[model samples]
Target: METESFEDKGGWVIDQQSFVVMNSSYIMAHGMGRPVKDAATTVKFPKTGKYHLWVRTKDWAPFPKGPGKFQVLVDGKSVGQTFGESGSDTWKWYDGGLVDIRNANIKLALKDLTGFNGRCDALLFTDDLKFTPPNELEALTAFRRKLLNLTDKPQEAGRYDLVVVGGGIAGTCAAISAARMGLTVALIQDRPVLGGNNSSEIRVHLMGDVDKNHYPKLGRIVREMDNGDPGNGNPDAKEYGDARKISIVKAEKNISLFLNTHVFKVEKENDIITAVVGRDIATNQERRFSGSFFSDCTGDGTVGFLAGAEFRMGRESKAETGESLAADQSDDFTLGTSNLWASVDRDTVSSFPETPWAMQFSDEYHIDEPKSDWQWETGFGNFNTITQAEQIRDHNLRAIYGNWSYLKKNKAAKYGKKELAWVAYIGGKRESRRIIGDYVLNQMDIQEGKFYPDGSVTATWTIDLHFPDAKNSKYFEGQEFFAGTKHIKVAPYTIPYRCLYSKNIQNLFMAGRNISTTHVAFGSTRVMRTCGMMGEVVGFASYIAAKYKTSPRGVYKDHLAELTGILKGETLAPQP
Candidate 1:
């Protein structure tokens, strides 16, 4: 018999005669980060039969074979109760049983003892008890094709009164409040974690209505998380500030969270949306749900676009909205994507890319300035961000690493040598497509402290713009970014309910950064806190609309008192 090590295949290696545990074999017994029972494999038999089976296992520590046993299956069925759990006294032995044969094909399966905590050796199996070429047997092409088809089709379905896309603070609150009102809700998020921009992925700090004099109800949800200030979450922290808060939200009876799922299509009937279709990453299955109303809390207005909702992108011109700061509007211009990185001190660095990294860039693309949150010019949608975060993450990594490499290798005088710190798993997005609502909030609205009686949200943030001219200036070069006119005349402004609805379509409400705000007003309302409140308003309105059997506008007109009462209950603080 020939022996092969498992470490050669980068993971476990399976062959016709035997299997080899490779790379990090210690994880097999003790396991890796998480105990993944689904990823574990088991063998079985077709029927009762006598078959030849060979087994081998390797461990960093001694194999705990005494009380722990490898389960064996015969003829697609389990045989006996269990085998091998004698409590760690034996090594390398074969036992033959006088079992009845019932099928032409037989399978042998090995299961590690529950809670086994050591490396496991690879097990060997053969029909004729002979080792041969790995690919001598025919490939299971038909089985694979069938499995693929099954995985691709959407299978899950349920009824929801309100479905909120995007699980940021806004979305989570939306789902929770709506469900509390006796409405079934589904919250879909593109990331694994919640809190949107405050999520570990985006790493932005969470902020909301704080009295400064005292805490207000607006921050009730976020305050549950003890991650220090709601705003200023340490980007380098391993976990999100509100990650646990998300767990509490998920535990709520009415809210169903679908993480790492993207809403690709919206089913509509006339002006009303019927169902939202989402895709699951693990199983590659699509999920559908029927809802009375839908909230586009995705920040980018993904649902609005799919529902044929009219929207806008980039800075709007004065000709369109009469906003003084509105520049020459163009669809190609956008608020740009964030390239996030976790900074660390040189003394405590790990997983830092070694020198001579493969993705180096020239001096032209280098950014040597020592600053936190350096914005790097990104390639335009080169990879599918929804499915592969690592794809976009790698681009940010390359941009960051390449710039550092360039500084050290070429421009040491202006840009001194720097140590490797940390990197972000994914980049954050500041702006994208904006859904055009009944109102297009302009910069002047913010400057004038404009308030609409129908306003559902109030925001106070500066109209920060990234200038194209500053793209490569000495003051700002190589994804060079600048914050336009801080401490400007902009003040607290109200966001109208009309601005949350599609001008062309009815019964759909948008929230978060993607709502019907001019580029300037979006700068303020886009903040996570305001967005969260926006979500709450939309969510409550959705429930009320369902209750009254009326349009969103109808709810605003007929049930303003009740709608305001619901919003007030959900922690929308009165503007000072």
Candidate 2:
């Protein structure tokens, strides 16, 4: 293959979708209104010749005319072809006709026509259209390696004692804790930064109590990492503190941090996961990370999914989990994702576009203008947070825009002078795909205050379950974008270590909301800081696993005493 492909760099904001062209994909000029700045990437052509430029893009919504549309620029000149508006559900390379490039240096830019998410996976220039690479994952992976001249083995990025798959509060603490224990660690995050939901992109302030009773060291790192307020962001004029989390991760010298890399596939040996395959979001370069143990901090239990681990999604029946909070009968409806937005009181009156595509809300569900925060959430109606994440986020965006538009068009005093200061396309998800472990924590464990020998990570938040807003669900029917929560108070209780690792997959451990908790119990344990504590416990357990050459279950079965000491701060290595 004489064609060389280039991945879109930082100019485009990422839009997360599971089972996409790559595990990671980008959206140009997302969440903002029509503007002029171009999302550009510089590429050096290997040979000077006339070649057909084909862009791999998708029409996210499978309508006649797609929601997103963009133009490709060659050497600052428009290619005259509007991409994304024409492709189907499957991402295929669209021919931008023929283009002549005499010089090696060529600048490719994405000029957006619609503010809707215009996605671009890769751009490949080839002389022959019939000889291009296949779009299937396996074939595509091999072709990418060959085109980039990458090794067949995926090129070992690093071998560590521990590899944490998610970079949320939990994954960060997991990596930090393991690094402090004199273990080499790798922290891989799909997004550009750490702190996952708490990161400014999502802007969910760290929740759950820090420096709690069961274990002080449990949330010690979280206390340090927790910056800004509880809602979306610094509600005041001040900016959100994302740099603090990055600073903490960078300060840990014993860890190799891979940001903007998504781990989509796993290499397993029987029940043990030997390695994980990750692709860089920016460069599209594939790397294999080898480790003694791996943590599925990737909130949807992504690592566990690829490794074929036994996992449960959505709620359990009242009879199954034996919790009153459980549904009458179990189905696939889990806690929905929160897509939050904030508006500032402008000095002058501002206007917003009418959101025709958004779901309609009744008077009861109608949001008051200039007053949106964590309360403005969506995605409980028939939407799967994993497969349908893009739709879920877009649905939220439409609701937010429509609400603002109604208020502005109607000339309401509440939002007459208000302007949308910030709106996030990145959805802050709560629950999905809980990897099955030895212990499936139920509400009875927390409410009954049942103590286990391997208890770790205290639960603080109530059994908060989110449902579709009654009025909104009635109006929108199957596509409700408004949600409401049901909370059940409970005394703080500890989560057992057995709930942290996969029951079938031996080397795989889990943290965050995906830990082995019954749906009802997860309602309380799903907060950011509480998830961090789970990560801390798993991190200590990983060290013990590496130290004793034990499996995750082995750490619990044989070394629970040592693991208890670590959680209690006795075995914690002094923080750097």
Candidate 3:
């Protein structure tokens, strides 16, 4: 049992003579501050049996202050995990023991998880003195072994009738609805906050029947988000009403909130999801949750996809679905992203811009050009949205600054040298991957005023599609900006429950812009208010499945009357 180390000019080393190396094994550098991968140096196991893995840290310098994290992987899957505790010396070593080392290639990954920032170390592999690598036969037996640890222990397995995978407006409502009806629920969220897009992170002002003159049920949740005060022209203040309301909802007792956590994998037993793997991003800890029923309200359909739920993405061709509004469809080409900006009244600000702004203005910044305005930031409606967001956000900042700069440099416009104060921290994405559901809502449904007695949510926006050629049209026809084929804003349409469940997988649901809808129908259904309602609907459905000990399909069928009764009672105000 000897160790050998070689140093290259690149400040990293490897032990070529280790006994653990198998055919496909190689040492590679990944993450911050490491040289590229090196060629393979194979090591043949003398005789196969159980083996222990010890990973040594190889850093350029002594250990710095604070804790650090690194990952050791077998084949490509993560196995051994280590953390550097405070007060540890530089280049500290940690041992990953008794791993069922069966993979042909075992590698170590050093990652920096600290906020202050540092680089990962090169890995030094060594052999276990007590045991040896397992043989092919032994490895086959080990492969069948399930890796169960305390981290994966369920606090309550199959105990909760339902599990909701998001804590947004829809998730919260669903959890409350189910819990109030005497069903156990597990509410999961990836953020510290419960609200999804409308959370404080994105900071979009809430809209719906909540603030409207006739609808107060729409306002029920929003009023809870208010500060209970009055303000002028400020949508957040008028909409939220008071800050105290937000505090109360955050303290809701029925919801078992797991924020700042992400669902990574799902385990299936027969056609049912037995457990879900979750990771707490902040702590780097992993856990498992088990429930009889599950609802996916991640907006992006993340959970549903992982659970092997059947879902679709992007628009289907008209020929395929007879969706009328569907055109020649492609994949990965979703809606645009919006970098929302808030304006500060110049009268309250004490500073002025020290530079010029705009593209040669003559006191008139308003134009019919295919562009955006900072006065009222509105986007998320562009072709090539992924790439365009980066361009639009940057251009938006530049335009605002450039405009202010021009005023300061010019004598007219009387803006008195104003400049942009700040940009939004979170960029809102209007559309992305949509989950294919059992039924995809179509454009004709909205046009014909079709109604599903089982409809859980309604959408009122028009079939607004951004032009394909933004830069060359009457506006920027070829540019990546808002371009709608038409605006059919006349009628409101219902989103059915079947369109949310997976077409192939059982017990999985999706909400938000990702739900099953044609691109045209999505343009109308993609709004946050509608998404919130969808969320609530999914949440309630999940609760019913858990309570009745049935599947979501069963709830949509035999229990339709009961489900509708509950939804109607949850109504915020009397319907017009």
Candidate 4:
């Protein structure tokens, strides 16, 4: 038997899911009826013979009709029918008939039948047709490991002084800061590109000021990596500056950047993370990275989740956090995720087909033209943006297409010449699990400007939280698909070094939205530029931890002076 996981698909996304523990990561095509190119991988047969192809997928909805469906193709020939058309709402394997193998080289391809979302966890080919794959997790894991020749315990990819997970602006800055200090570093990102939300995929324009904060050189790397284009919403590659960011990371000598790698496992002992295991999304292979220090730049706090670090989700009550702006009583309600889009103006007339399956807006709220900024957001008021990521994305996509359809079908003359420039398949998230650290910064901290002895990076953005659009909320109630933000301004405040390290997990340092902060303070700290500065501070602190061979918390408790020196751009000498 031979197997291939779509996680290894280079030009694809590994969307977040809670209802499914998929054998492979799945991609959601958000183009509505327009066909989007899917993922592909090559396989070599040990011996040429007939092979029965099977795919691991699900209908997602069993009672009604399934929205997700796709077909299998071998050597450019269809295996006959779409596999995800009919199956249990739960995950299951489906047969794709037999194909005679004439050549050693094989090309496996997926054709998305439904533009909504056609998911496939893995593709399997077996010599014995009766040998059905197992549905259970343990059995399936062993089956795929053996079939794919993957080690249950991954082999070491390399040893690094520091390993930064999540290749957003935060992770990028961390790697550069540490590597420039002569520390060997590894930066692992799930997506093909860096910049996280600001990447071409998500397109959130970077906010906040650099050099104005306590640390002048904190966002130096951010500015260097940026293409300097302030435009948003499907701007040109030059505007997004993807190439420049990649070039900067590639040029670093002390850094080993791993792109398209999903970090899934960790090895820890006595609260110290010894190594991290990342699976190459395109090949289903694994690589283990050993490090003395680790940074969680993942906005969702995934590393903390895998490592058993203490974290907080949703809002903290006004009583618990003592913030007047917080909810009277807290529950799991975050800012939610956004799927944004834009349109292009051409010399000739163009048309967009009406999308019948998209999310709806009231006739008055129906979008006529295109949007090119961050305001085109959705998924709020108790929406599970992390677990129900795909569903939330679909809701946004539906809203996009449904509104466009309303304009095209009812008011054609106005939008007849406009064509879709881009619609992000990737969803931009604002908040998730904030891993517990030595200090939980709250509204009081930012408002009072309480400075710590270990104060490092400064936060500049206002406390901004998104709720459902008031009018849209009136119409859709619980399923509103538009965002309305409430911004509370505050003076620039410093984040303590204690806020960067995991409280329970010793070696793990966290940056970005997942850093230790109350919901209200997270509003200001969650900005990309502020997160980038957190990375810069964490990088230097990581170097101190390695230099003194101490735990992350030890950097503050025992070596604050040296860490403070780095943050203040003082002497290079270490003091412990």
Candidate 5:
């Protein structure tokens, strides 16, 4: 049985961030070092007898011992051995010995031993002791489907003029802009909410200026959904405007918004994408969406990657990109992800338990702030923002909890009344796979204010690159959680439309941080409002492509003038 499908989740939260790498969404016990309440469910056995149980879990921190230890309870009885104490880092099945089942209907529960981000993917009970579950993701997926009676074929979701994957600020703007221009659009989001980092789940306020670009009306749609500058990692949930964003998308009659739907498969012919397949996060039911054109706004370039689009993940060498800001040598050193958190002052003093399993912090070396903001970040250098996402998030959580514990213990007088009000589980990612395009935007293009004829979206943010703070490194070393940034100011430069569509994939368009930009140029273009404008350009380009029956490249080569006119507030077609 899938642990995520438990009747009562209790304190365990559904984490789908690493679903791409892990293959399935798992439940995490994020009780801040305290043991979380049991996640209980009822299951029926085929026959009443002795059964061997296998639990799919991982040792998140497998150094000395796994901190994420948990037990599987059958009818409120322990399943012999601890599940997450296998000492292996990868996700594997741990033998839970055997349990005698007297009744067909029995109570099953996951008892979290220590709340240091313990996770459970699924569980299996077999009458045959010799049988073992598949460890490989592909084989395991087939095994799960056959066991659960899930169909291999996906249900049709309907055809669209444009299919926009990811419901972040960029994807939202893309769908809204296309819908306003009379395109039947499908906007798919993996999360329950519309906004990504800007959503209440992450609470990062929107950055970059809107409506200050060459194209005056380019950011109008983005401005309509703007939640104002609430600041990063704000404790107030209402400040980020989740309802406003969803309502605006729902108001568009031409757009079909799919929330909690994660697109994982892509169907292509020759070099053009034909359809994309997604699975519902809760039900695991797959749906297929066909479109004339597709947009990869998934920040990680998920759709593009599946469609065989050429992409880059690490920073380019200075010799290769001819940018001074580029790294000395091309390496896997992309910007990190942030899991921001905050604390609140309470009327009564609150006590926090010491987290011995977490990263130990002393009075001399600890973040002495009441809350976390952008500075509290992780996943840099060797750490991959995609494959190692869960580890990065857990590392950030360790830092937050460990630092809070230190503050509470050392400076009781100052922090005794403070309580952790909010902590973001969904990571605010900065850099990942950058889908290659016709013209790659570089650092010199932004710094020297270089102009292209097809300049569509104006980027106003600075070339802000983050690195591990020297002070933080002194304490945490290679596992540093804190970050420092150097913002290099630049004149507002228009990003070329050539950077918006894929070079190899015929009909693929991109926006957000995953746009065709060097690691250095992404420092400026990664902000939400700038990405929103990129989406606007993609939307207009999609209209031109649909109208003229051309590819994204065809729009640039032939219908450039028409796309520019549409961007400049000249309505090409009436809203349907």
Candidate 6:
């Protein structure tokens, strides 16, 4: 049985951030240093007899024996051996010996011993002792499908005029804008909620000014969904407004919002996209959405990458971009991902166990804080944010837990009553793949306030680039958990409409941090409000494309005036 499909998850959380690399979403017992509640489910055997048990898990930190140790309980009885201590850094199956079944239906549970982030992918039971589960990702996926009785064909989820494959602030506004213009839209989000980083799961507040845009009404949809700013890493989940974002989307009659759906496959003809396929995270069911135009608002450029769009992942060299902020020699260095955490003060003193497997902290080395902010980040340099996402999040958890443990032990006077309130399992990512478009905006464009005939969205944030904190590097060199930034202020500048749609992929449009821009220019335009305005511009462009029966490039090259006029509050009716 899949551990993530447990009937009662208890204190475990579903982690699907690295599903592309790991093949399946797994449940993690992230109880800081304490053991979490048991994850239990009931299963029926086809035949009551002796069966061999196997569990798919990993020893995330194998040094000095894995700290994330757990055991399987059948009817509240131990299954003999402890799992997650296999000494293998990668995911593998652990043998749980043989068990005699007296009843057809029985209760099964996973009991975590030391919750330093114990994880389980799936469990298998078979009467054949020689039958071993596949260890490879591809083979494992096929095996899972066969066992779960899932079909190879995906269910068709009707046709649409526009399909937005993300539900962040940018995608949310894009769907709303298009729906209001009479275009049938499908807004797909991987998580259960609408907001991506700003959602309650991540707790990052919205930034940038919507009222200061080139077109005053460009960010109207964004303002409609705005929850009050509660600052970054706030412990109050309601302050982030997960419900408000969903309610706004549900009110749009022309939009079909699919939450907990992750798009992984793209259907294309020649250079244009025809349909996108997504799988439900909980049900493991797939659906295909066919659309005339598509938007890649996924911050990682996930849909764009799957559609084979031209993209870049790292910084550009000074010689290549000719930007003053560009690095002397470019490498694979991009902004890191953050996993913010918070602790609350209780009336009575609280106790936290020691974490030897976690990163050890000293009085001088610890962060010495109750809550984390934007500065607490990881995954820079050689760490591939897409593939090594799980490792990066685990590293952040270690930092938070280790530091808290140190504070509880060494600095008890101030932190004795403090207890971990919330820890973000979903890593709040900043940068990844930037889909290339008709024009790549550079730093000079913003600095000189260059006039492009198709300037649509206004960007007001500074050219802020983050690096490993100098003090943090002294304690943890390569795996620094803290971040620092140098903000170069710039005048509010307009972003060209040409930078919103893909250059080669005919029907693709992009927004958010994944828009076509150099690393230096992206620093200023990556904020949410700027991204929302880009979505507004793309929505107008989509209407022009549909009315004129043209592509995104045609809208820019031949009908730029019409698109600009629509953005300036001129009314245009949708074609029947």
Top candidate on lDDT is 5
Model 4, 1-576: lDDT tens digits are 222354234334455343235545555444455655766667788889988877777765433455566677777788897766584656677877887888898787777765655666777778896888898888987887787788677867899999999999899999988888779999999878999988988888788777677766577776786666566666454577787788898889988989878888888997788999988766667899998889999888888888999999988898898799999999888888877777766778766664444555455766555664565666554566666676666667667777876776676577777776677778888888999998999998888777778887877788898787787777768867777887888887899989998999989998888999998888888888788888888888888888888988988899998887776678564321
Model 5 per-residue lDDT tens digits across residues 199-248: 99998889998857888779988898798899998899999999999999
Q: Candidate 2 overall Cα lDDT vs. reference?
A: 0.77
Tens-place lDDT per residue, model 6, 47-148, is 898999999999887666668898899989998989887778788888889998889999999999986788999999999999999998899888988997
Global local distance difference test of model 4: 0.77
Estimate the TM-score for candidate 6: 0.97
Model-by-model lDDT, in order? 0.55, 0.77, 0.50, 0.77, 0.90, 0.88
- Expressed as tens digits, the lDDT of each residue in 1-576 for candidate 3 is 111111221222221111112111112232111223322223344454456664443322122433223344444445546444434433333455655655444433333332111223223333445643333534622421221122435343234666778666666555654555556667777655665545544445443332321112232443344333222123232243223323543455545666656676787776677778665533334567787777776665667667666655555687776776676764444555444433344554233333222222344542222112222222433433333333344333333334444544553344432333333323455665567776778888877767787776656667765443332233333333333345667366667888877766677766667788777777787765566666667666766676577787788878877667656664222211
The better-scoring model by lDDT among 1 and 2 is: 2
TM-score of each: 0.66, 0.90, 0.60, 0.91, 0.96, 0.97
User: Who is ahead in lDDT, 2 or 3?
Assistant: 2
Error of 5 at 164 (Å): 0.7
Report the C-alpha displacement of residue 287, candidate 6, in angstroms: 1.1
In candidate 2 the C-alpha lDDT for residue 234 amounts to 38
Q: Model 1: residues >4 Å from true position, as ranges?
A: 1-147, 150-153, 207-219, 222-226, 230-235, 329-331, 346-371, 374-395, 406-421, 468-487, 568-576
Give each model's clash number.
Answer: 23, 0, 47, 7, 0, 0
Please report how far candidate 1 places residue 189 from its true position, in Å: 1.5
Model 4: weakest 10-residue lDDT segment is 1-10
lDDT of 2 at 260: 79
